[model samples]
Target: MSEEEFRESGGRNTVFIGRQKPVMSYVLTTLTCLNNSPDVILKARGAAISLAVDVAQITIHRFAPGLRVADIKLGTEQLQSEEGGTRNVSSIEIRLTYPPEGQGEAAKA
Candidate 1:
């Protein structure tokens, strides 16, 4: 979801959507979300699924080693395009649960 959509979700801001940004940027975002909530869900589609995994790993290993991957969900979304009538895209949701002991400072270093 977009930034506006995320805000419009009514206080449900624990989700981080992976995009074509630097891995560290995504890592920071995930850490920020984790600081605010008990769990942060990283969602990505297609090629971004790999990036999402990398962000989760880096956030766990580098910033919050105590963090746990509570769950992982995989699915496919069908989208319609002008050229291609319909195409299937892979999607993944990695749920990183349990905030670090040092909450607010998770992303400081």
Candidate 2:
């Protein structure tokens, strides 16, 4: 989903990982988790996929060990290239879910 659409979903937390530095992505992910969002979706396209993965890892392992990956969806979209030709670009959605109270890491494992 687009950033605007994600934001419009009241209870949903979403982050778009673009070409910016990975550190910035990490910070945003951390903040989202700290905000008590039950689930967070990390979206990235094309070359930014690796950066998105890094952000998710750092957020889960380092920042929020209690969080776990709930699901992942991957696909490609056909877009008009700068050269005016159709091109297929890869996209990914990584969903992280925080366990409910009293569940903790045991439930995740």
Candidate 3:
């Protein structure tokens, strides 16, 4: 990716945060980011984690022909709730990669 394309993203694994939006919206965004970078990451918490997986699947299977899931990390985050109490929220990170020529599938990490 160019310096100015996604400056704040810092290149390589550009990140996309999941939310209440439709799955296709995220799918398109990941595809667009992949156009410039070699890898992309989709992150989500709580109920949105499932939507993140759907977005990754749609983008890898139906959209980008050669894209593959490279890695996946799951954990929990503690955050202060609106009522002032702490909460543990489940989170996930799906790293999607477009392997170099002749390195597909075998290059998964």
Candidate 4:
């Protein structure tokens, strides 16, 4: 969800709700398909969590080096069925936060 949408959800200041919100809600939007059997889990070498989590975590790390293990939050994970539907797979949707406002532009530098 967009930041605007998230803030509109509820509450007064529209500021983030928790200490973890800054890191947990950051996201890079993309769609990818897993080419393996739905039963197989994605693996990342030399990283924490499962391979799937590593995949997402590493991507975030490429941008946000300060990302702590505790900062990661797994949302929803699913497999695309042969019928073009989604099955709830073991893989998860990972979210990472972008740095504060001005840093967004700097991150691209």
What TM-scores do the predictions have?
A: 0.75, 0.77, 0.79, 0.25
The candidate that wins on TM-score is: 3
Residue clash pairs of candidate 1: none
Q: What residue runs in model 1 are displaced by over 4 Å at the alpha carbon?
A: 1-11, 99-109
Q: Model 4, 1-109: lDDT tens per residue?
A: 3334433543321122222323333223111221121112222112223544534555446644533332333433454568998765331323333345565555678
Lowest summed lDDT window (length 10), candidate 4: 30-39
**Which is the leading candidate under lDDT?**
3
How should the candidates be ordered by TM-score, best one leading? Answer: 3, 2, 1, 4
Better of 2 and 4 by TM-score: 2
**What lDDT does candidate 1 reach at residue 69?**
88
Model 4 global lDDT (CA atoms, 0 to 1): 0.35
Q: Assess the local accuracy of residue 30 in candidate 4 as a C-alpha lDDT between 0 and 100.
A: 13
The candidate, 1 or 4, that scores higher on TM-score is 1
- CA lDDT of each prediction against the hidden true structure: 0.75, 0.75, 0.77, 0.35
Predicted structure 4: clash tally: 4
lDDT of 2: 0.75
TM-score of 2: 0.77
Candidate 2: count of backbone clashes, pairs at least 3 residues apart or interchain: 0
Candidate 1 yields a Cα-based lDDT of 0.75
| Model 3: residues with Cα > 4 Å off, grouped in runs | 1-13, 105-109
lDDT of 2 at 16: 72
Candidate 1 C-alpha error for residue 38, in Å:
0.8
